[model samples]
Target: MDIKFSGVTKIFEPDIIALEDIYLQVDKGEFVYLVGETGSGKTTLMRCITREVVPTRGQISVGGNLLRKINRFDLALFRRDIGVVFQSFLLLPNLTAFENVAFVLEVMGLPPKEISERVSEVLKLVGIWRRRNLYPPQLSGGEQQRLAIARAIVNGPSLLIADEPTGNLDTHTADEIMQLILGINAAGTTVLMATHNQYLVDTYRHRVVEIHRGRVVRDEEQGRYELNGGC
Candidate 1:
């Protein structure tokens, strides 16, 4: 899916600006990294894309659907095509790995056989198939992350939004998680990853969009974490 931000600006009450005159476009099948320091409006910009927080000014379109134009009835259907992975794996503690992924499909009213097949496929893809019976608390950090990833992709979303997906993991585990994400991107899922891992940003070498103080400072191809006097 493609994402376009046209002169997007966001401001909170009491005259606080979270984003200003931001213009960014991410094409389909592209993996772009959103980099900035803490409180730099990175999360707010992403929230605009998901329409969780409406922008104070300007417009955001995802996969050609204008966020402002989407009605309440269509919003749920629109979000089904978008997957979100958070820094904290928000898994259901009472549900096993298989049940977690299946829950998404079940809510969509898919047939039982198809849900089982799809859940199994994603679980194997994320390398958590053997532990499909384990609950969230029973799994290790990496395992839980894998389960989260599996659930996110099980719906075959066109766009994947990952906010600090590897933040809680160690270096080695982070690398493994990156590999899985990259593999997903390779298969034509547009990825928007907000992260602070400079090493991974430099090593992966994707397009980078850097924001500072609610403004876009840099957008570069094969970009690094640090730029000339930029974040």
Candidate 2:
């Protein structure tokens, strides 16, 4: 999961520059935090890696795929190798937890038995196997978030992207969820997590990349949260 960003920039319009000439890298098996304030381009960087948005200039290579240069027709297969988790759970209100996990596998064209086995495995990995039959409406905030994590990793993606994953949870729940992410990282999924939690930023002390005003403001190993009264 080697990722390289070389002078990448994204401008939505004449005045709104989401990111500018960002150069960075994530070595294989490394865990990193992308930390910044609102609209600081953390999300933009993640989206660029995931191919959700196109870059205006420069280059980004994740694993072996040159995301910024890939053809539109080839994006889907590239996406399957990378997983993304968001602040919102994004669960289907009408679907059971089992169905939610199964849905991703189905789209990827796995066999029925394989999908069933994989769903059970990942839900348990996230500690939600018992709630597999429940709907999103029946779960707690943390539980819902865990379900989102389950869905993200069910396909066993080599690279994981989490954008403000704990934004919607309470403090204790946030801590637990962050722990879950770290545990996943420890198991060798190269992780790039975008967060605003200063407490979490201070606690983990992993590789940190800070963005400010659409630029890479700071990047450090085992970093602490600073600036704007954070940490």
Candidate 3:
């Protein structure tokens, strides 16, 4: 769904400012790219949306739910509507591919049958079903990433937040993963992806929000990674 950040500011202890007066709005079903240097506020902004880091000041809302006001009891429910994919493929090494995705539904307390159906559906969707019996360490980087994406989207979240998801992959593998992410966005899932890959950013030609030093420097529609640049 839609995300709105109004005058949001976040400061860590000992006077470390992670975000400052950040005001942004992402419409539902839009795919937006977050581009910035390392240590920029992109990750912090994503974390704020997920309530992993509460805003030190101002307000943030996702689908009309005020983040700062959400209580512990409702936080889990709120997070169910969002999916996160990290740069490192954070798959369970011990669990098989199917079990890794199944674990998410299990924790949500879904019935065994329903979990089996949903897990199967997503594993196939990510093209990892044939490798369902494989453990994380047994899969290639691309295969592991596919499994990670499958696990993230198994719950059918409305919002997908990815942080450098293709960073650790080769060009061809990264392109494959990017296409899968684009397909998810095409299916009307709101996407916020943080990346340093200029080729993908420019080629995709989606909305670009550039952050620098904990502040938004630019926001553009159908924007390239850099001005006067194209893939």
Query: Which pairs clash inside model 2?
Result: none
* Candidate 1 clashing pairs, residues 3+ apart or interchain: none
Candidate 3 C-alpha error for residue 71, in Å: 0.8
- Candidate 1 residues 19-43, lDDT tens each? 9999999999999999998888888
Using lDDT as the measure, the top candidate is 1
lDDT of each: 0.91, 0.88, 0.91
Clashes of 2: 0
The ten-residue window of minimal lDDT in model 2 covers: 222-231
Which tens-of-lDDT digit does each residue in 24-103 have in candidate 3? 99999999999988887889999999999998899999999998899998999999889999778788899999999999
What TM-score do all the candidates reach, one by one?
A: 0.96, 0.94, 0.96
**Residue 105 C-alpha lDDT in model 1:** 93
Candidate 1 has an lDDT of: 0.91
Q: How do the residues 46-70 of candidate 2 rate in per-residue lDDT, one tens digit apiece? A: 9889888888999999888888668
What is the TM-score of candidate 1?
Answer: 0.96
